[model samples]
Target: MNLFPDAVEELRLRTREFIRTTVIPNEPAPGERLNPAVRTELRAAAKAAGVFAPHVAKEFGGQGLDIAHWSPVFQEAGYSIIGAVALNCMAPDEGNMHMLELIATPAQVERYLRPLAAGEVRSCFGMTEPHPGAGSDPDALRTTARKVAGGWMIDGEKRFISGAAGAGFCIVMARNDAEDDHLAGATMLLVDMDNPGVRIGREIHAIDRAIDGGHPHVHFEGCFVPDDAVLGKPGEGFRYAQARLAPARLTHCMRWLGLARRAHDIALDRTERRELFGSPMRELGIAQNMLAESVIDIETSDAIITKTAALLAIGERAGSSLSSVAKVHVSDAVFRVIDRSIQLCGGDGVTDRLPLAGYLNEVRPFRIYDGANETHKWAIARRASSNRRREVEQGEPYRADVDAPR
Candidate 1:
């Protein structure tokens, strides 16, 4: 039986058409490309085609697709690295939209959220910081937002911030009060990127060349914001950030799955025709094995992502546990698939003659963003242990214990 409804299939077909016709034609050659402008044109086309922001609510000029239905649509967009950009569903912006919709006050919504959802402005999250600041551990955040007259002053440096260069505003995280008992004492403030105290320090060259609003090293030199700049409540920053991350990571998995499929398709096409020692490459045992593994990985990734999306739609707060598992599995799977694709292509794979080299470079960061594989594994294991301990204490049989030797 099909898990998804008829609407999902219809949406998938529509999105596939959009991707094949509208998106693919616009992609620039490997070496010749520009920033923001290329993305702008694509966004306009997506808007005109009525496929922009598939996940955002319909009231906000989006399709308002549910999580289950949106997963396939996002996967289709992932087929082309630039597809998400064209559809206005790219990162930082996509995650930022979710946060603003959930927490922004009416005034904040009017000022920031509305423009963002309308695709009139670009934004970024200023969370990840350099060494000695918040990196993997958000609790280590050292950026401070000191209460001042009618507002607050934020001071800190944010590194590896995507979309910082062209962002009209930034959602900044900073320590609110040291006395709070919360594990991670922080607050999120929406700071105008144009503020004198806020500086775009430098652009960080990333492996992915298609990225617009380039990732940059940012410095918040006593940046000031009115009291209303706070998103949600104080001391709730970490909670809100984590909430945004779960869905964001799922979307990343969905997109990368498509990318991996694209790479595998390319490799499969090449192998079918290429002669190897008087035989077709597809006849080679190693080539066949790689292709089979790629197909399995992509299919598995799709199943996990769709199920996770259903969990989120039901308001279950699926958490990092499932998302982390998906992250590690999908990232590693996609990387491997792309690596094998490149290997199959031989010298052409590593060269700019084809897209495999760029695809390989792009998929590499999927392992790090959202949450690194190692960190998520540790968190998942701890959560599993805690659940098992609780179950045993309550005289309930733990699944692991049931399978364990006395």
Candidate 2:
């Protein structure tokens, strides 16, 4: 069942208006540089319009819209590459806010979550490590937090950390050597980005052009945090990260779905007008096939995301199986749609004349981040096999036909 209320349609209309008038119009040109001050002003304006942070709860000064309701709104925001930035619901920050709200202590909330929720401060989640470390395999976390005095001493390096440059704080993941199991040994520490021991190594210029804070290489050289800096339980870092990723990836899919839609629309407009071989592009059979395939991909991606969102809203962790399906399907689907759009736009698509090229570049990483598609596939297959084995042991009919094609 969907989670959107009957009033959601009205809300969606208002959201569309806000996105069109306030967000899209304010986005920087393709070649234009990012201006933090201008972004801040746009965020303030979005906050005033009552459309900021749709995914966050009301207690955090957000609209408190649930997944179903938020899906359309976020999709609308995705139309412009900078739409989420203007609304203050962009990545790293949005996911960080959710984690802090769920696990941060009262004092920690006041110190970090409050400013973060209010968009007064920004934060990043530091988990990705350099090669031979925690990249996709989180169990390979090399960062360590050792017990020392009244708190812990954190020392390690984090690579590809988003929002670190201008972030006020970071939710740092480190291995707790005290734990017997390395997976359970992980601990999340809230560290001030400006901590003396916390060094900003280098700014990585990612393919995504609209990212507010450049992804930074972060070094934690004996960064000490008090006992209170621990988020949730001491050794629940992996669990907390898993929980955060489930919804975070879904949100990404939702936003990127919108981006794909925008590309598709742009392509359609071009196809209807541009002529090739003495006929409009839209009259070509290949053009029609591409458009048709895009529609199917986008609609299917929407359905899968909506179903997963409903499961999440009811407090059921759909886990890696469903999430993996959504991730792989959506990632591939959106990429294909964007690719087709670029093809339809011809040389203009590759050029900076429109947002298509940037959209394609930004979505390229979806298959890699959160979790690699190949990894997710293996996990999904293993789980499915185990479930089938259990069913066979219990002498239950497998009913493979129900899920398989004729």
Candidate 3:
């Protein structure tokens, strides 16, 4: 039997259909960016289909689906490159929206969350920065936020910020000069992108072109943001980031999982039709082995994502631990699946004749984003060691309980 409830199942099917039909048809041509007009049209179509922003609250014009219900729906929407775009579930807007809902004041929600959920504008999360700053290590954050009368002055440079180019505003992470501890001083602020002192550099061309507003560098020089723009409390940016990233990491897995599945489907279709050595490629022993490995990878990734999604839904103690594991495993597994599929498809895979080419570029960067797999692996190891030590001291059976790393 299917794991999802009937309503979730139905929503999943509808989302799949919407992606296969509406979103895929309007996807940008090879090497082309999605134009504004097409984006508007897609948003309108998704709204009409009642699938826009499925993860946001119903009061804010979204379906208000929880994390568990969102898993299948997001995967289905991920079938096409533009699927999440049509539904307005694409990040960093998706992640930003989630954060705002959890912590923003009602007025803040009205100003930012509502418009964002409605797909009226986009947003970015500013945390990553150039070398010598907070690229992988958040403690290395150099951006400073100093309190001023009636406002705050934010100063720093952020690089490789996704969705920053065209975003209306950004949830900026900066160090609070008031606090002595760098980590404790970090804060989140909502700054309008158009502020006089906020300068957005040209988009940084990246391997992945699927995300709108290509990752860009931003400079905040004496950018004055009102006191009301602080997200949550002044010193809780890292905490809030952790809350945002856990779910965001899962959603990224869900989307890439769908694309990886699609890659395999393309390869399978090619194998069935192409003749090699007087037999269909699918009949070859080597081809079968590749296909089997891909199947296994996809199945494993799906199982982990599903189980993790369920755990997250129920707020299980092991949920965060599982999410980190899922993020690392699924990201790598999906990449392998796409790679094998590309090999299986031969020339067609590397070409635009199939989706594998773009998918490779799209999935490659995932290994580095969210939290790097290396970093996650390090956290996982530490957690395991700590858990083992505690269990041994208590004379209990060996058990590991780990939470998501901040």
Candidate 4:
């Protein structure tokens, strides 16, 4: 658990201790999510402990850890649902800060990323829409933005927009068909949530209650923002999305892995104590196998996460494809580990008596979000096929042995 690099080892340990002592003590009752008020308090404590916003730059009031270094730190913070938010690293805020840091103009940075990194505000990334719209396929985005006299008019309805209810702003993805503009195609626009045209609808009330702001319906009707509101270049929304999502996916894996470890630990404690037929249950063969299998799952998930993190740290051109691999594998692995943990806990697992049920609900959506696992699998398969196609066309001899030409 402590194989982190020297630079991050102390911070990671501090983060774990912080979560165990500070964040876990403040966990809300079962089935209740953390509200802004509670989150504000935790953020203050995290700041005092120098553990808030580890991913943002120091100039932005963060600890300035890069993507590779974030693995253990984020994992520690994710041991409890409250921990990530307390450290100001929960989505969509965490992902928003990352995107803003990468793409925001100076004026935009001053207006958005500064307070966001300081934990003064929260934001949402509005990419997914209602059915028949974007969802897992962002290319199917339904939002539209048209050039106006001074700026642009945004008109669209985004559903299942995480943190939309109380977000200070939103990074909206809208298509611009006008080829005459400075740039066309899909565009990223930063829209203030308080804009006259922004409206928040019903809270989705999803099964998971751990996200700081519950996902909700966000409608943008005639919302207008100056041309200065554009994030990065026009026609580069998808590019910026990849910039945000690729690393965001890895971080999600990191956090969920921590939760999965917690679940495993809970099961381990129970098995060691439970007596069946006047003997310790954990000593039985089947129960022992379940524990061993979960350990395998957790360790493998960690290895892939570490590898993908390294690829990300170097800004590897293959990072996105590798991220897809990590996302699909880690997501499934975490779910398997947690499901087994719950089974090991027996009756107590399904009830609020243990956090296993909530953990299950939280991780179940991961497969569907950040691009569904099925979508990632299809993409990964295509990439492999493309590589093989190139090899075959190049007249390279095929081999059946592992790591050979075949």
Candidate 5:
């Protein structure tokens, strides 16, 4: 992660310019996903701008940025809703790409990671499922993969699968029937979307529409894949998931923080032009307070993203719990920034004319996405309690798992 200081800064500035000049103009009306034609055009523009796939390895046609370096560049990409897509760093795809690079074999890298990082195809992560299945608690995952002679037979259904509809493939997580328990029995597999037994159900119309490949319901009935389809190992799905989520959640925070900044910028502009009772609206006490609070929110969010990113760069899974901390705080902070922006902008903010409402719609789910804030709070408290108990028993400062690779 010790990239040249100058290069990272230059990339960040270029990304900011690229987002403003290229992606935002072409951004579809608020609450709508980009059409294929527009997406293709923006990606080309991103490639020309030298900002595409900044997180992927350079050997794979990307800039080869590590976790720490990704913070500034990714936040810049977040400035516009379409910015991440243009740069080929959007979710499911970006997160899946990270996971692929971590465990994909040379051949798998060529078949999947290469095409995905190059923007030649799209992919989805199949973990979240319908109620009673895996959601906030992944241990409850119901998708099962039964052992077969040459491979596996995967079954069960998945809901809220981002990029499921038009994705080229799915990185699926399924419980190995032989494991007999919910804990360590799950496995990760790469499932081609065109497999005969794979069934894509109706799309789930969620609040965030800017996201491509609208979240859809998916089913796998006896879907079979050969031995090589297993991602890392038969029973280490949760570890790989932790490996994927720690950084993925932070990247989400980075991108949304940029969107929150966008909302704040929009509000600040309104304040300048607005006048009330023959006095400048910007001079009002509450107005000034809102602006100052948003500044605080933005700065603090950036600080947390930086802290978590640094922990992840040196030790891949080191930030697991800290990422939960980042997720809960960043998500809530960004939402408040957006909400305050809406309040500052007055009536126009709620209308489609301004993107504040759309920003709210997109960010509101973030509190629940990547695991709910309450769930994260519970996990944080449990970890703290466990750490305290160990600290007392050992009669030493129990630094906990933050430095250890989870």
Candidate 6:
């Protein structure tokens, strides 16, 4: 596939213009969240501009762009912090929308996916739990879902759940002890936030402030739902979650890539306008080195993100592993780009005087979220070593789907 799809060029350009003209001007102040009214207003403007939900399918009242199309469009929306929110493409919701569309039954789609895609309501994915529970380790899941007369009774606690406060519902992952297959014992269930057993705790104070509702702690005590609430097949939650994570990770890269680029642009603008020692700062060799480094980081990041996006589009098994690599590389690269931009801007970068300062705060958290960079590094090394052994023993080229002999 072409690096830049010709068909989505207009939509991508439109999104960039909208973000530059509409969204950036209305960025919420540091430590301040966007009010619901303002969010509604921005969403309306985005819908009117035809850039709303550009990655969602047309059947769901979205722009119907595929993963390839989303790469460019999401990057454009990332230019402004509110750009993704205005376009209704922010995470948890965006990722949940993808999950439901792929696995939700027709009824589940009608009740959950449709409204979410249309931006009628918000949603969250309940996965990471407290220390004693599941955080990073899916096998440590303490949440249990027992089969009941009509449905399942779920009991668990989830922390750092983004958008849980005002969310209409959540896609909860829980362990099913009844299943025979160890890997298949985990299942996903749809639970309405209004359910009696569902309790939303205080919003976690995180470094980043862009996500709606912030991240909240949640408790599910005997949460009951009908059989229809099951997302796909019972005991297949882990598989489905993996499906969601691969693309979600890439989307994160795409959005952050845009933010880093924005930081670079702000830095370049500042350097060009500010003169030091009777010459433009950008013309100075020191400043030129910083600019050159940022350009390399940005280009390398784009190459990895685009290549990974292509792999995902083709349904390659290596896509998942590559996505992990992309997540690690792009997250760190983008962080450097933003950090360099901050240093280049000097005092203005640290202060909220310009967008680079805030972008720095925003991009910093990306390394930890969506599977920590260190975790990805471990996985990458483990997989590479295992794949190499298999190649040596079998005298064959390494393939993504190959599993090391037990």
Among the numbered candidates, top lDDT falls to 5
Query: How far is 98's C-alpha from truth in model 4 (Å)?
Result: 0.9
What is the C-alpha lDDT profile of model 5 across 270-367, one tens digit per residue? Answer: 99999988899999999999999999999998888898898888894547789999999899999999999999888898998898899888889888
Report the CA-based lDDT of candidate 6 relative to the real structure. Answer: 0.88
Instruction: Give the range where candidate 1 is weakest over 10 consecutive residues by summed lDDT.
Output: 176-185
Best by TM-score: 4
Residues 229-342, model 6: lDDT tens digits = 989998999999999999999999999999988989988998989999999998999999989999999999898888887888888988888999999989999999999988
Give model 4's TM-score versus the native structure: 0.96
- Could you tell me how far off, in angstroms, the CA of residue 133 lies in candidate 3 after the best superposition? 0.7
Per-residue lDDT tens digits for candidate 3, residues 1-406, read 8888887788788788888888888888877778789989989988898888999989999988988778889888888888888899998999999999999999999999999999999999999988899976888999999888998899999988999988999999999885545435688999999999899976788989888888999999999999899999988888888888888999999999988888899989989999999999999999999999999998898888888878878878577788899999999999999999999988888988787889989989988998799999998899999988888798875435544344
TM-score of each: 0.94, 0.94, 0.95, 0.96, 0.95, 0.95
Q: Which ten contiguous residues of candidate 3 have the minimum total lDDT?
A: 397-406
For every model shown, the clashing-pair count is: 0, 0, 0, 1, 0, 0
Whole-structure CA lDDT of model 3: 0.89
Instruction: Give the alpha carbon lDDT tens digit for every residue of 1-406 in model 2.
Output: 4446756666566667888887777777775655788778878887888888877888888888876566777888787788888777889898888777888889998899888888898888999999888987899999998877898899999988988888899999999865435435789999998889899998887887666677889999989898888898888899899888888888889889989999999999999999999998999999999999999999999989888877877777664358788998999999999999999999999998988888888899999988898888888889889988899899987578775656
Off by over 4 Å in 4: 1-3, 179-182, 400-406
Which 10-residue window in model 2 sums to the lowest lDDT?
176-185
TM-score of 3: 0.95
lDDT of 4 by residue, 154-223 (tens): 8988988888877899999998856447666788999999999899987797887777567999999989
The RMSD (Cα, Å) of candidate 2 is 3.0
